[model samples]
Target: MSRAFTFPGQGSQAVGMGRELAEAFAPAREVFQEIDDALEQKLSKLMWEGPQEDLTLTENAQPAIMAVSLAVVRTLEAQGGFKLADKAAFVAGHSLGEYSALAAAGSFTIADTARLLKKRGQAMQRAVPVGQGAMAVLLGLEFDAASEIAKEAAQGEVCEAANDNGGGQVVISGAKAAVERAIEIAKTKGAKRSMLLPVSAPFHCALMKPAAEEMAEALSQVDLKAPAIPLVANVTASRVADPATIRDLLVRQVTGMVRWRESVLYMEAQGVTSYLEIGAGKALAGMIKRIADKEAAIASVGTPADVETILKTL
Candidate 1:
């Protein structure tokens, strides 16, 4: 069966996420060590033994999550005799996980991916002053309906849909007041629930234009190669293997809504029958299940034991 590999993004991180994998496998430990060397910080320590505050920071969480995902990828290749290039039809990730997908597919070196994600996190955090921007989830509303509500609630502000996660879950981000306004409007427009997200900055909206610019500049300097497998970009919701297109889309993704539902459908239509989430959490697997066909299988690899278990699938 054809399978696609997907990675998790923010909100999937937790203390001690990669500790088990690192402890059980030498390759997993090496992935964390490489990342720590690249960033010159013992982030893995915080990830394994956090007071919770520093590990939760966007700058730290971005690369930390990627490290775990790549650790899983490296482990499968090392011990399971699994090769993504030979087995997977496509690869994708949600938000920051895109870097993990790229790195796993050999588009970017793990070190470069780590450095880029660190910059991305810092740039995103600095794009808007905290407390002036926010994000919220609107459940039970279709994307078109949520988009309309966001537009109406904007009132010349920056409210916009950020993530169209399947099963009627839509996330909106922009100015704080506009986000709250959109939440109220969504409630009136038949939303089952709308609540503010505890996020440090509004992401994937007009307010992120500055972050997009920053990423453009940073991405220009980073060397990118075509991945061994196709990557379904978040903004375009289609497979992209060209290095140039990947660079441009990554910049746009900073301000573009994550079209996750469409991306999953695109893979499903292209003959992918299974999805493998190699990361700290099962967020992408959960979303894929909601958007995929009834027969599609979804699995996650978060620890050394999971790696051994999935070997039977291959």
Candidate 2:
């Protein structure tokens, strides 16, 4: 079956995420060490022994998640004799996980990916002052319906659909008041439930314009290469391999809706019959299952044991 390697995003992070992999594989330890050196911090320490609040900070969580994903990839290659180009047809990720996917596919080096995500997280967090912006999830609603609710709730204040996560889930983000209004509107419009998310800032919306611009500056300076495999980008929900276009898309992704549902559908249409979520959590796998209606094989590979299982399959 045609396969895709997917990466998890910010929310997938948890304390002690990579401890098992690091303990079980030398390559995994090296990958974590490299990321720590690149970021000039003992990020692994915070990851394995965290005051949950500190680790949950956007800057820490973004790079920490990428580190775990790359650690898994490295362990797979070094110990299991697997190469992404030969084993997967495409690579994709959710939001920040897009950087992890690119890193796995060789579009960016592990060190560069770490620095870029550090900048991205910091930029996103700084885009809108805390308490001024917010995000909410609307359940049992389709993208089109969610978009209408965002528009109606905006009342000229920037409410926008942020993530079309499929499985009857759509996340909205914008100015706090507008987002609050959208939640209420969504509830009135037959949504199963609508609740504000506990995020530091409203991400993936126009309020993130400043973050997008910052990312443009940060990305332009990086040496990005075309992935060995094409990337199913979040902004467009389509495959992209050109370095210039991918760079542009990464910048736009800061403020653009994460078209996750469409991205999965596009991959399925292109003959992807299996999806491997190579990261800290099974969030993407869960989403893929819902998007594809369990017609495709889905696996989450984070621990060494998980790696061995996938290696046998490969």
Candidate 3:
């Protein structure tokens, strides 16, 4: 069966995410230690024993999620003898998870991925002041409808579709007023439910232009190699393997729509019949099930038992 490995994004993070993996596998512990060394912070501690507020901070959450995802990958490699290049037809991630996918596929070192995500989180947080920018979920609306609603709500401000997560879930982000307006507009337009998300900053919208610019500079300074498998990028929802092009896409992704639904569809079209969500949570697996709408094999590998279960299949 053709397979694709997916990674989770920001909202999937939680305290004690990788504690099980770290305890169960030496390689997992090594991954966490490497990330701690790279960032010069004991992030694993915060993740294992957190004040949820601190772990939820964008700067902390982004790399923390990546660290857990990589820890799982490392465990799978060591325990299952699984090789991504041999098994995965493609890899993809939502927002910051793209870096996790890249790190798993060997495009970037684990340490570099951790550091890059740290910088990305900080840049995104700094792009706009808290409360000035916001994001909202517009459920029961298609991407086209959500896009129009965001446009109408802009009112000379910046409101745009951010994440086209399938299952009639779309996230719009921009100026707080604009996003709030979009929520109300979505209500009038037959949305099942519309509510503002409690995000620190507007992500994946024009308001993140400064963050995009910052990422461009940050990505330029890093050495990125072509991945062992092609990545279905968020901005394009298509396969990309050229290192230079991938770097550019990562920059654009900061302010561009996360075409997650389309990306999954693209993978399905490419004959990816099995998807492994190798991360902290099963959020991506849930989305993939909705997106594919087929009897595709989907699994989440985050713990030792999860890893062993997948290994048997492998």
Candidate 3 matches the true fold with a TM-score of 0.99
Please identify model 2 stretches exceeding 4 Å from their true place: none
Write down the worst ten-residue block by lDDT for model 1: 78-87
Pairs in clash, predicted candidate 2:
none
Q: Quantify how close model 2 is to the true structure by its C-alpha RMSD in Å.
A: 0.8
lDDT of 2 by residue, 1-314 (tens): 99999999878888898999999999999999999999999999999999889899999999999999999999888876768898899999999999999999999999999999999989999989889999999999999999999999999999999999999999999999999999888888999999999899999999899999999998999999999999999999999999999999998999999999999999999999999999898988988888984779999999888998989888
Please report, in order, the local distance difference test score of every candidate based on alpha carbons. 0.93, 0.93, 0.93
**Model 1 lDDT per residue over 1-314, tens place:** 99899999998889999999988999999999999999999999999999688888999999999999999999999886767798799999999989999999999999999999999999999999989999999999989999999999999999999999988999999999999999988878999999999889998998999999999999999999999999999999999999999999999999999999999999988999999999998888888888899899899999888888998888
How well does candidate 1 score on lDDT at residue 44? 94
lDDT of 3 by residue, 56-155 (tens): 9999999999999999888888887768888899999999989999999999999999999999999999999988999999999989999999999999
